[model samples]
Target: MNFDEFTGTVQHRLELPGTGEAVRATRATLTTLGERIQAGEATDLAGPLPMEVDFYLTGAVAEHGQRFDWNEFLDRVAEREGQTAPDDRADVAHHARTVVAVAAEAIPAGQLDQVRDQLPADEGWGNLFELVEADGAQAE
Candidate 1:
């Protein structure tokens, strides 16, 4: 439901190769989001939630030494790296942005239904996000 329970469930249930570190990184990112919200440094619409989630995922990917096509978009938008000027890259950025926006909103809703709807069907981070959503909903 909350961060602690969500993290705990991930630590227990998920069996990804590097889920442990991912779980830890996720918690840290969520904490940062909470802090930013408290400080009024960000809002849900400005895309802080998705940006933070990607930032957290980027770190986890680097830490695990895993490669993903989405990494570049994560870097370009989340890390504010070089502009993605080409038409294809622009499309990638747009898709990632939408994914982030949905996931971010689901995180706050803390409902399994909402999280599952937002998560990608690919079954890694998406599954973990769903787990958090489920736990959050159960708590309520």
Candidate 2:
């Protein structure tokens, strides 16, 4: 999928009113994700994505990603998404899951595997990709 389709699918999947909200969710989730994933993994994962999608992960932090768990990761994404209200938790999880699911559809399987495998195994960070994998499985 190209940028338009990618964003459109995000909007449709999330039942958002327009591409505008999808773009907002995508940018927030993807950029914040860039901050959590290793620079090299980010680059490799970005390689197969559309230019617009890849842009978010392109200038990843110089250091190897920060040590943050899945909940904090969601918090950052929710914060970046401008929906920090106490009642926004459900919306935040839905946004994160939806955007990542749609982007996962556009990414090449090989690259996706590299990403899932490359992430740190010691931490519960596996939850990061769990949604994407589950989404992919459901699609099949």
Candidate 3:
């Protein structure tokens, strides 16, 4: 429903907070944790895991503020992620715009998802990804 909730769910599923690199210490931890789980060496899958990470972004363009709608935000996230939601577009758009403003100001190129994970699920990730994609497209 919100960015934090969404990220928390993802982090829980991944069983580890992501490190900045595609492969890093977190990967090693996951492997070991996985082995432990498989061996029944650990009782709870969620508890033994390390602390969740917060991948925030930073840049100059990120400072200029903007606004978006929550419904639109959800729709965009669903659209980008290839999922479906039964919410009205207008309502979601409002939250989306607000989240976009925050991401636009805070995130840098390398840590969009990290920063996005900190946002409300219903409002920030979609706009943040859009900006990241736009920047990536322009670099080509």
Which one wins on lDDT?
A: 2
The whole-model lDDT of each prediction reads 0.36, 0.74, 0.33
Mind giving the per-residue lDDT tens digits that candidate 2 earns over 1-29?
68888888888888989888888888888
TM-score of candidate 2 on Cα atoms, chains taken together: 0.82
* lDDT (Cα, tens digit) per residue for candidate 3, span 5-83: 4344334433444522212222222232222222221222222122231121111122212344434435444453333
Candidate 2: residue 61 Cα off by (Å)? 5.3
Better of 1 and 2 by TM-score: 2
- Judged by whole-model lDDT over C-alpha atoms, candidate 1 comes out at 0.36
> Candidate 1 — which residues are off by over 4 angstroms?
1-6, 12-14, 39-138
Arranged by lDDT with the best first, the candidates are: 2, 1, 3
Every candidate's CA RMSD = 12.0, 2.8, 17.5
Q: Please give the TM-score that candidate 1 achieves against the real structure.
A: 0.26
